[model samples]
Target: MLNKLTDAQVKSATAEGQKQRKIADGGGLTLVIRSGSKTWWYRYRFAGKQKTYSIGTYPEVSLKEARAQRDEARRLLSENKDPVMARRTKGIRQQHDAENTFKAVAEDWLQNQETELAAETIRITRRRLENWVYPKLGTLPLTEIDPPAVLKVLRRIEDQGKHETAHRIRQRISQVYRFAISEGRAQWDPAGNLSGVLKTTPTQNRAAIIKPDELAGLLRAIDGYAGQPATCAALQLSPLVFLRPGELRMATWEEIDLDNWMWVVPGRRMKGTKKAKRAGQVPDHKIPLPRQAIEILQPLKQLTGHRDLVFESIKPGRPISDNTINSALRTMGYDSSRMVSHGFRSTASTLLHEMGWQPEIIELQLAHKQRNDVAAVYNRSARIQERTKMMQQWADYLDSLKQGADVVAINRR
Candidate 1:
């Protein structure tokens, strides 16, 4: 077939009156010219229907290159194949590979974990992933991720003094890789075998003022804490309730009954396997509030009466921040080494045990659920009246210390 256009004509091609014009080069090859740009197009019949394929743009794709591509398309047609569909299939395959990036793969892994992971666990994890992992390598192809790249991300967190969190993120990354490998998407775990590369977080007991006199001093400091009312209340309530910091901050008004002087934290909020929490397979943790607890909650209701959370943070619709109580402790001259928010649980458990409260009663009050469900249920129901009495007495003892009266519990009832 005789070609109607040459390399020179196509290179200098332009549209007339701002309208697009097409220059045919025979055998289904054509040059499409617009006012500002020229593009190469391959027009042919596929499945008895006319179709146009954009080869590329001018200057970028020379006439010689365009003709070669056009020839390939005709060859495909002669072989009884649709060039458009074939090219589209190739494009789609490329897109699929691109979509298997680190972020995408990690998300797929997280979805798979949802069946067994708690909702809160999943939320915090995804937040950590988005904050720590995604910005570094979220868009990279999963197969292209290397140990060096993974280590770099972990080291960034370690630099911020979050060695434990760095380790956690690394573990999550490794888990994602394992999931990928199981599905045959990845052949290697980039996050594996670098465990010793980072500093090992030390295992140690939490700092606590287990002595009554020292505990008195800390209680006085909390009383004088002139910060946000919500934060101040959290500080005061922490020692009284002795719940985990997360459990304490997330306390909802519905969970506590001032009239009955009791609080019942649901299994969903209690720490457990994701499946157990989502399925409500775990039992509730109940607390018998002292009269003092009621005094605090009564006035607190006036401040946050309309809100869902009793300890709602300054930011509306959210619970008090995870770090708020500890940050407030810092404000009152208590550092992490001196007194962390979680130390309240340690202090309460130790002193309660020392004061001659039954180990089972103390453990039950602490919501230390046994691994066996039957034992946990028995522990939950044990000593209900005595637990209520102990809470009232504990509150009274704390008041005496705060009043600057030296006192000690030497015997149990």
Candidate 2:
């Protein structure tokens, strides 16, 4: 077979009046002309069957390029492979690569996980991904991201002395890889084998002041905070209500009953598994508001009462950021090692348990997820009376503490 088509010949070729015309360039390559359009074709046989492979359009797929493509197809045939099937496989792989970028898979995971995960968990996960992972690995295809590439991103976070954050980002990356594998987007979790590769951050209990005198000092400091009044009120209310930072920050007026002295924290805001949240298996948490809580809210009501969120941020229509309370604490000379917003729960729980309150009552107030759903439902109303009493007394004890009363833990049980 000899080459029968030239670049000059191809430029002049046409099927102006005719519907279609074909010119063979030998050994399976052909030029098909349609009225004003031209295309390159490689007609070949594989496994005793004929197949026509479209190389590309005319000018784009020049004669020299078409010959190269035909030669490549011939080489595939010589290797006992079907060029058409081989080409289809390549195309499918390319499509998969395009659709399964690390960021694309992560976004899909987030959307798929929203129903299952608590709102706060979803928010934290998304924020972590957006800040740490996306900038480094987002555009890269999933399969192309090996352990080192993923580790490179984690390393940058670790280098900043954010070992815990680095670990968290690694966990997030691993989660996305797991999702990708489950969805047939990735072959293996590169992050899975790299567990020992990151610095191990020792888990420390949140910083809190359980001692009466120190806690009283913290209380007085909180009372004097001159930032936003809403924040000051939140600082005053956090320990009394026994809500997590997120639950406390996201409080809506609808959830509060000043008259009844209660705040109903919706299940979506409480911590739980994706399945529990998605199925609505996690029930709403009822908190008995102490008199002190009511006192703080009553006056603050005049300010933020018209808003949906009780602790509305300065920015309209949004709750305060998770860091707002912690930042305020920092502003007041308390660092992470000294105390945190979450430590308020720890502090109250410690002092309450030490003050002779039942562990069950404190756990219920803390909204710790119960292992047994049946027992959890049974205990929902188990100790409301005791909890209500404990709350009021807790507020009273704090009031006494703030007055510089060197008080011992009261045995109220």
Candidate 3:
């Protein structure tokens, strides 16, 4: 009967116009039929449970291969391993493999950090993770990330001579692992124990300060700058207020009370020192806006006052980047060592002291906190009137130096 059922007859069971029905093959093999189609499957029972293993499509898998798969499935079935159970186990393994990809964990990390970090900081962190970490470990599972795997990525960044940025990347990896743990996606953070593993070179801090005499040269460079207008304003204002680089770039018109002659730095933007808190209202810094400074604002107000920042870039809506000031400095032929925008603060503090200006006045103008708590609180006039005068004098002093005029050096007597 097996020989009489020609291979053509067996194969034709899957052909069109045939009623869907199972055609039996010798030895537990059957051509399962449904919807005018057939597929070869092996049927057997394991421990009172019936099971079927799909071998292949009808004609594509010849009778020979079907028989071969059936024999293999049966041999395993005899070994007390049901073919169906074996197939289920293999599928589970593949599912786990799919879940362990790097992109899987990175997405988890990104979502976790979104709440705690500032919007700009989050954007930067996401960019680095996507561009640097994903390409390297995107296909790897979180459980598989080891010290070596992490080090390989950091090593690549280090090789490019970006030591500072490489340090930040390592910190980011640690944060990602922490994020994973918080989400219950990972058990441990391998990045936590990896601090001293890499050979670190000692980094010398560059103190940003411009000397008083050298300020003339710096002013000439800035005045001579034929570059971005926003940059020129930043350079001109750095000495006037000496706010932090971020606060300077992110300054909005709302914070500046020109009518009151005060730059009321909000509580959020004020430095986190005890002095900031003790000086109620963060001592709304009366900038004593000079004529030149007010002139700068008139055009800038027409330009950016409608938006959040006082000095937004020409690109529209976006605040100027933190680097715009320093980049402008570079464009004017000053290297990082030569002069930084931040260094102008130090320059003013030093020169003002040399000019016999009171330390309290200079410190107040610099937005520095008075050291003695009670004294700071009690003395509301701690250079209040004097700072207004000092600011004007300083502006005039800058103008004189810029024109190469022999300005009256501060009398330290």
Candidate 2 regions exceeding 4 Å error are: 1-71, 273-275, 278-280, 302-308, 313-318
Local accuracy of candidate 3 as per-residue lDDT tens digits, 22-104: 77786788887777566887878989977778888867988877887877787887798888888789798678757756677
Ranking by lDDT: 2, 1, 3
Q: How close is candidate 2 to the true structure, as a TM-score?
A: 0.79
Q: Which candidate is the best by TM-score?
A: 2
The per-residue C-alpha lDDT of model 1 at residue 160 equals 91
On the 0 to 100 scale, the lDDT of residue 184 in model 2 is: 79
Query: What do the candidate models score in CA lDDT, each in turn?
Result: 0.86, 0.87, 0.72
lDDT of 1 at 149: 96
RMSD of each: 6.2, 4.2, 6.4
Per-residue lDDT of candidate 2, residues 1-413 (tens digit): 74887889999998967899999999999999998799988998887888899999989888999999999999999999988889899999889888988889999999998877766688999998999888988988998988899899888988888889888888888999889888778879989877798889877788988889998898899899998887888888887776888889988999999999988888877777868766777788888888889899999899989888898889989988889899999998999998999998899899888888889988988888789987776676578888889888889989999998876557655
Whole-structure CA lDDT of model 2:
0.87
Which model, 1 or 2, shows the larger TM-score? 2
What TM-score against the true fold does each predicted structure earn? 0.71, 0.79, 0.68
lDDT tens digits, residue span 173-212, model 1: 9999999889888889988888889889867788877888
Clashing pairs in 1: 117-274, 118-274
